[model samples]
Structures are given as C-alpha cells and as structure tokens.
Target: MPMKLYGVSDGPPTLGVRMTLKALNIPYEYVNVNFNKGEHLTEAYAKLNPQREIPVLDDNGFYLQESNAIIQYLCDKYAPNSSLYPNDATARAIVNQRLFFNMGFYYSSIGAYALAPIFFDYQRTPMGLKKVENALKVFQIYLERLNSKYAAGDKLTVADFVLITSTMCLEAIGLDISGYPLVLEWYEMFKKEQPELWEIAKAGMIELAEYNKNPPDLSEMNHPFHPTRSVK
Candidate 1:
C-alpha cells in the first residue's frame, strides 16, 4: 500500500514533507486538513494525530508526526542510498544538527514573531522581533560555518528542505533577508535548481498571503493559539 500523508494544503510543514517526498521520488497520498474550518480539531483527525498537528505520515498503519522526523524517516527508510540524507556519520550529524536548529530556533522564532501577528492578529512585540532577528543571526553564523551550497553541506539534504520552507515563510511576510547574503543566495539558487519543489512552497505562501488580506472571523479569533490569547 502507498503511504498516506495528512496535512494542510498551504502549511509550511506539509510543504516540507511534500518536497522531501518528491525529491526522494517516494510516492504517497496527501490529505489536506483545513485548519480554518477546524477540521484538525475533529475526532477523526485527533485519532490519527492526537496532538492535532498538520503533516502526519502513515506508512501502512504506522503513523508518525513531526515534520522533521517524517523527512528523516522517508530518507532513511525509502532512500537510504540517496545523498539527500548522507550515510556518512559526520555528514549525517551535521544534517541532524541543522534540522534541530531549524525546529528550535529559526522556524519557531519566525512562527512566533512574524506569522503569529499576521495570521492570528497578535500584536508584535519588540522582544519577539528581537528573537526573530537573533535567530536569523544564528542562521547566518551557521551558513558561515558550513559554507556550502546547502545548509548542512554541499549537497541538498533534508536540512535544506526544512530550513528553506521556514525561510520561504519569512520572505512571504516581507521580512528582509538581504542582510544574510548567504541565505539570499541559497534561496535564489534553490529557486532555480528546484523549480517544481519550490513552486509547491511558493503556492502555499500565495494562499496564505491571500487569506491574510481580510480580517479573520470569530472562530479564528477565539482560537487558543490566537496571538492575543495569553499563555496559561
């Protein structure tokens, strides 16, 4: 049986997994969960993913959550010989480090500061912006340290697939990434190199930007994850 992936149509994490699947030539079915309609909150989805997050992968009834983990699993299990996930211990370690950095730093900060304000109507705080900037600075340092065509090293790995999705989101929000020349260069290179996969991410950004044009409704307003909601 073919693998099944559940995710939002325009979700960044979903895009990352989709791109990874395409790059590895792994065939899978995609189920788009409409978060705007609260489809993810339904009992059926909760059973598939108790955490109620997008981009859940099911391989013959073996379910998995978390975008990074899914990407690594696809590469490791389906395409072990693919350089997109190097078998070399040192190279793979770098890829793993970069993936963790994206989850803990780059992606998290951007979602909190940049996306929360636009999508959830959360007020942007100075501290939040500072955190985003600091994350970018660290990304710049990582680029300098790796000094390769991709995030982890010369070849494109799952790290590039994941980080690029976050950076694409950053760009969609009109955050100027010019200060980080390496990132900008990397983005441009991938834009040309991986046109089809890049289009998958770009299409999602376009949808998100369109959705942000109008004011959100009561359902969106009342969501606990809404920007204005105070964390307990």
Candidate 2:
C-alpha cells in the first residue's frame, strides 16, 4: 500500500510532513482536504485523526498524527540514513524537548500574535502587531541559541522541519526573519541546501498570506488552529 498523507494544501503541519517525506525521497499519495469547504471537519477525517487534524499519515495500515510524531515514525522506519531523527538517547531527548517547546511556545505565540489577529476574531486595541512582536522577541532569543546549522548541528533533523514550518507561519504574519540573525542563517541554509523542501514551504507561505488577506467564511472551522481561533 502506498503511504497516504491526508492534509490540506499548504497547511502548516501538512507542509511539514510533506517536506519530510520529500527530503527522505519517500513516495506517498497526497490526499488534499479542502479547508475552505470544511472537509477536515468531516467524520471520515476525524476518524483518521481523532484531533480532527491534517497531516494524518497512513503507512500501509498503520496511521500516525501530529506532525513531529509522523516525521519521527517515518524517519525511523523508512529513512534510517536520514539525519532527521537523532539516534543517541540524550541527543534524541534534546530534540524531543525542543520539539515540545516548539508546539507550546513557538506555535502558540505565532497563532496568537499573528494568525489570530488577521484570520480569527482576535481583535485587540492597539496591540494587534504587538502580540506578534513580543512573541517573536522570545523566538529571537531561542534562535540565538538554536541558530546553528541543522537541528543538532551539521545534519538536518526533524527538529528543523518543525521549526521551518512554524517559522513560515511567522513570516506569513509579517514577522521578519532578518531581525533574528541565527534564525535567518538557518533559513538561508535551508534555502540553499534543501531548495526543494524550501520550495514546499515557500508555496505554503504564499497561499496562507493570500488566504489570511482575504479570509474565507470559515463558519465550520472548529479546529484549534483555525485562523479565527481564540487566542489567550
């Protein structure tokens, strides 16, 4: 059976999973879920991902959700030679920690500061862009520490994929990558070395910007990451 990725076109997590698969040269079937039409809210997609999420990966009969977990599972199973997942226990633990942090701090901040404001009903008084600026300042600090090439250094890992997709959201929200030197370095490296993977994210960036610019009527958007989600 071909590996199938059920995801919305250009969605963040979906983009991350697709990039990982491409980097590993893994052949998979792309199942595009129409976010504009509430396709992901359907019962079938919910069954594939109890979270009612995108980037649900089905390898043979085994299924996996959550972008990072899907990336790890595929790297360990199909791309053992790929540096996307570290082998050492301690180093692997570090990657897990940062990955968790990305989900918590990185993604949440961007959603609140960037996506929520423009897409969602996240209205504020004189603090619209401020929300994103503050969160990006925190990311700048993290990037200062994490600015090194690759996730764990020299070799690209799943950590890079996670950050790349998340940062794409930041840029979509007008967060300037150049403001943070280290993050910009990593960004340039990906642009140069993994041009193909970068292109995937680049496509995502453009669509999201346009969508957010003229957001559709998402009356059925119930997912946590929907553009009109509550940001507190």
Candidate 3:
C-alpha cells in the first residue's frame, strides 16, 4: 500500500515534506487537512497526532508526525544511498545539524515573527522581527562556512528542503531577503534547479501573500496555537 500523508497544502512543514517526497520520487497519498475548517482538531486526527500537527505520515500500519523526522525517516528507509541524504557519518552529521537548526531557529523564528501575527490575528512586534533577522544571519554564516552548492554541502539534502520552506515563509511575509546575500543566492539557485518544487510550493505562498493583504477577522475564532487566544 502507498504511504498516506495528512497535511495542509499551504503549510511550510507540510510543503517541506511534499518537496522531499517529490525529489525522492516517492509515491504517497496526500490527505489534505484543512486548518480553516478545524479538521486537524477533530478527534480522529488527534488520535493520529495529539499535537494536531499536519504532515502526519501513515506508512502502512505505522504512523509518524513532525516534518523533519518524517523526511529523515523517508530517506533512511526509501533512499538510503541517495546523495540528498548521505550515508557517510560525517556528511550525515552535518545534514542533521542543519535540519535541527531549521527546526530550532530558522522555522521557529519565521513562525513567531512572520506567520503568527497574520494567521492568528496579533500585532507584529519589533522584537520578533529582530529575532528572525538574527536567525537569518546565522543561516548566512552556515552558507559562508560550507561555501557549497547546497545547505549541507554541494549536494542537496533534506536540510535544503527544510530550510528552503522556512525561507519561503519569510518571503511570503514580504521580508527583505536581500540583506542575507548568501541566502538570496541560494534561494535563486534552488528556484532554478528545482523549478518543479518551486512551482509546487508557490501556490501556498501566493495564497499566504493574498491572505496577508486582507487578513480575516479571527476575533470570534479560537487561536489554534493558544488556549485563550492571547497574543504571544
């Protein structure tokens, strides 16, 4: 049986999983879980992932959540020898480091600063934006040190997929990416090299941009990230 992925199309983590699947040419069934409709909060979905996160991977009877873990699992199981996820201990270590960076710093910064205010109906704070810039600067330093064709090294890896999705989120929010020259260059390279992935991820980005232009009134709706709908 083909794998099943429960996800929201426009979600960055979900898109990262999708991009990884596409790049690895892995066959899977996509089950869209609409956040707008609160499908993810349903009892059935919560049984699958108590956290109510998207991009839950159902591989036969086995189920998994968390996008980065899902990506690494796929690569380890399906594409062990693929350069996108190297088998070498040292190289793989570097890739793992980058992936953790994405989860801890890069994606977190984007979510807190860029996406949170727009989607959850909060005011954007200067402190939040500064944190994001600092995260970008760290990413820029990574690129400078490796000085390779991709995030982990010359060869593309799951790290690229993870980081690029977060970067795309930053772009969707109208951040000036030019300040991070290495990131900008890397972004352009990824666009040209993986045009199809870009195309797949772009629809959600366009939707996000449009949504930001005229945000919905979430006063009546419960904030999914918070219990009391209080801004963080």
Candidate 4:
C-alpha cells in the first residue's frame, strides 16, 4: 500500500538513501535484507530488484534501484524545494561531475581496498594497503577542492552524502583523514550542518564498523572472512 524500501541494515548505500528520506521528511517502510544470509539472492527479492542489491524502492507499482536515484526520486516527488538537488545548470553540472568522480574514480579503489579490507576482512596486506593509499590520495585531492563551495553551489547536496559515506569507510580502514584540513572542516560542517540526521548516520556507521570488527561466524554467512586478516 505505502512505499516499501528494501535495504540492508549495515550497508552505507542504503543508509544514505534512508537518511535522505529522513532529512527530506518523507515517510516510507524499510525492509531489511540479510546480505550475509543471501536473502537478496532469493527469487522473492530478485522480483523486486534483479540486481540483487539493497536500497530498492517500490512505490505502488513503480520500482527503483540505486541509492542516489532513490534519494533523488524522494526529493523530487516529495520535496522539490530541497537543497539536495540544484535547479541551475552550473550547480547541477558540478553535482553531476562530483557524482561521476565518486563512482568512476573512488568507487573501485576505495571499495576494493579500504572497504573490503576492513569490512570484508580481506586482510590489509601490502596490496590492500596500496589500493587504499591510492584511494586516499584521490580523496585528499577531492577534498582540497571542496572548500566552502562543494559539488553544488553553497549548499549540502547528494554529492556530500556520497563522499561522506565513503569517507566513513575510509576512516575505519585506517586512513588518517586529518591530514586534509578542509575535509575535516567539511566533515565537522556536515555533522554540524545537520546534527540530528548526522548523529543517526554516525550511529549506523559505528554499528557497522563494530560488527565488522568482530570475528564473524563462517557458518553465519556462506562467505567466510578472507584468511590473513590483520588485527587492528
């Protein structure tokens, strides 16, 4: 009857969409898929999202996937006036560019290195550290450009959400983001700018990180933690 959202409890992509809904004051039902249990691979969930990813949104009969798209849809349909998406060309272009960079550049390096190493327990071997280093270098460069003027005009948009999500993973993976003063400033600003939503997001991230740190039961999920994991 009402909007239904399929998501995982611990994934950042879904968390970003959920937070956007909260920030925009949109109400929806959240359905949690246990990724570790491969619930997403079941035929029932596949009917909702063929890709078997979390953060799928079903509104009446309309279906949507991808975290950014879900957030944009909520903003466009429920709160067109929200600062999440800019109306102007330049500002919109900036947001798009940053989003592009986020996906194209940072996604691979960061996901494989920082996120996999820590969250997946792939082990931060030399190769893993190198991948993380490359990603962090890109993050540093990216943050340097995010002065008071971020991806869009002077407001917080989806771009900031995407960056911050990945940054949370980066921080947990043993990267010292403090070297980037502007990034630290921006992180503080994102938290201060939306204290309530940020607090909720921070709590979610902390829970995810803590869960990842624990020794997972190999039988809990078919996917066992990669051997050679380093204890931090």
Please, what is the whole-model Cα lDDT of each candidate in the order they appear?
0.82, 0.74, 0.85, 0.69
Q: Which parts of model 1 are misplaced by more than 4 Å? A: 215-232
Give every collision pair in model 1: none
- On TM-score, who's better, 1 or 2? 1
Badly placed stretches (over 4 Å) of model 4 are 118-121, 149-151, 218-220, 223-232
lDDT of 2: 0.74
Give the per-residue lDDT digits (tens) of candidate 2, residues 70-96.
Answer: 988888899776557778887687677
Give the per-residue lDDT of model 3 (tens digit) for 1-232: 8999998877889998998899999999999987755677788999899888787999997899999899999999999989998999999999999999999998898888877776664567998989999999999999999999899999988888888888987788889989999999998899899899888678778877776676644445454555322323
What candidate 2 gets wrong by more than 4 Å, as runs, is 124-135, 219-232
lDDT tens digits, residue span 1-232, model 4: 7788898765667777777777777778888888766677678988988887787999988999887778778877887876777767777777777666666666556667655654355655787667656666666666666555553447888877766766666665446767666666677678787787676567656765675666334344444334433345
Q: Alpha-carbon error at 169 in model 2, in Å? A: 1.6
TM-scores, each model vs. reference? 0.92, 0.85, 0.93, 0.84
Root-mean-square deviation of Cα positions for candidate 2 versus the true structure, in angstroms? 3.6
